[model samples]
Target: MVSKRGRIDTFVAKRLQIPKKMVRNLIASEQLFIDGHQVLTADTQIDEFSLIECQGNVLQQRQRAYWMLNKPKGVVSATIDNQHVTALDLLAGIDKDLLHIAGRLDLNSTGLLLITNDAKWSQRLMAPKSKVTKRYLVTLANPIDSTYVAAFAQGMWFEYEGITTQPAKLTVLSKHQAMVELKEGKYHQIKRMFGRFQNPVIELHRESVGEIRLDDELGEGEFRALSTAEIHSINVNASV
Candidate 1:
């Protein structure tokens, strides 16, 4: 209730069950605040994450939540799904409705997944201009050779999208496994990239997103809130 972002007067009125006139009066008397700052106008906009206070009493104070989940195979990166278990379903005792996946992995893919209620934070992390790197460990059906390294660096051309991929870094970890780092995520990019070599990706596990690595202690389907440093590492201009 009163969760959508809108003018402060409207939010305050709905949240407090008071008249709009009373909300304006509270603002005029300097008795209303948003995010700890005094509201100067009834028209001031506020989102669900905004901290609202009045007369030393908390009207609404919703802290931004960020989490890192070790997504297991077959779990869809969605808030809800009818045919499968969504990533949000794995979270316990948290407001799952307000959370969304930052960088989504396919149902068959596993590893590091970012979930948060802060839309701005997630948007910045996933923005193309941000160029945040995502690293993955891939197991292929065929042996990886030096050619694969050069091919990835050169970038692959997708006939359907009609756009070439950005230069990616690939390190051959073994005859059939390698580490891949990319600044962009396209539809089935990893699988399709391997497809160019006629090799199938049998396993794909993301290791990190930008500077936030998957916690070694988190088991599959387990998650923990992101640390202060981890949340700030995305280089978002605004505070969570």
Candidate 2:
């Protein structure tokens, strides 16, 4: 619901179809907001144009964003990995419950990854049914050949743990490099699949995921809050 004049927490909750008590709790916790500023009192009212950011997770509202990171090599993606420093370490002050990595990225592989407090955004971006496009740039030890390219584009077989992967895009970007766009992400997939071709991947970088791309200006380990425009783009692209 818009932050209309004369509206309160209870009214907004009812309009959004969320429980009033839950909305009140968010307000009490200083999680409710008016135009990006936190509001502690639920009774605070504003004009319809005021932006509302509920620290409360509203499934139907779909307004929060998880950042897409172009993960760098040597950084573990897990939140807790044998007590070793992981990607979560970079999110210094974020509330644990409001933040989580959207998907997996191997320690050696770097690329576009989603991190967010919004569970629906996470699920929608990572779910197989969503078919969100994921692109990667790979460096190989040996030059790629036409034979490998044909087999990959035609749907090469990938077997791991008890499952075989469906076909994926495998196009050569350069003599010793290739670009792969995949809809499904598997464990050590890019390295494993190309290993069959006798060309081991030396380095990997994820360029983009879905409609979001890693900001080139953001240095490694630096982060910025997601804007409302970026968040809105998620829904706009998902429908297509």
Candidate 3:
């Protein structure tokens, strides 16, 4: 879990479910150390990912959590935001601040969003080398045709990014809606792809990442902790 800055004593008290006075007494007895250095006062700030020990025994931190959220349209995909509510805020009964978003949804787009406290897992999920497939449902302003599918399959050169995107899978659902799967994230990739054909995107919703699909049971703004099998899905490389 990402450590929130606070007094070592206060953090220990809350984390261990003990009293602050007891934490102070433990520190005074030279029973506490932050990352292997003995500290006399509880006032010391806890550093991120620092190990805490009491009387030579390491304190057990809570297990890391992996969750899937049906992100609402208005919330930002961040841990903290000054002017908007973040997706983490929807989570209850947990240290939401310790959680980090794996794949981000745009502010107006809504769908399956991944959140977790495992930094390395999140990092790997977003890494270019992983090539995890991300699936989205897109609605367009105009009716689309076979040309759109062919173009996407062949890969398109995005002028703004000055790079050709990897070949993407596009399936036409209706004249104005389609389902797309991409192995790489580009800035506004779907919208930009349709822009080539003079069609504006009316809506976009993510449906899944890798093998971990958003639970259909989850309504907008609702989230559920991932099961062990679902958590393991992040490590699996599968085509959407």
* Top-lDDT candidate index: 1
TM for every model, in the order presented, reads 0.91, 0.68, 0.77
Candidate 2 residues 1-240, lDDT tens each? 111256567656766788878878877778776766787777787543356666554322323445656567778887677755677777777654445787787888876666776665666767787787788889999988777776766655654466666567878878999888888888887888898888888988887777677778777766666667666666666633
In model 1, which runs have C-alpha deviations exceeding 4 angstroms?
Answer: 1-5, 16-19, 55-57, 236-240
User: Runs in model 3 with CA error above 4 Å?
Assistant: 1-52, 56-60, 238-240
Higher-TM-score candidate of 2 and 3:
3
Clashes of each: 0, 1, 0
- lDDT of candidate model 3 versus the reference: 0.85
Give the Å error, residue 114, model 2.
1.4
- Model 2 spans with C-alpha error above 4 angstroms: 1-65, 161-164
2 versus 3: better lDDT goes to: 3
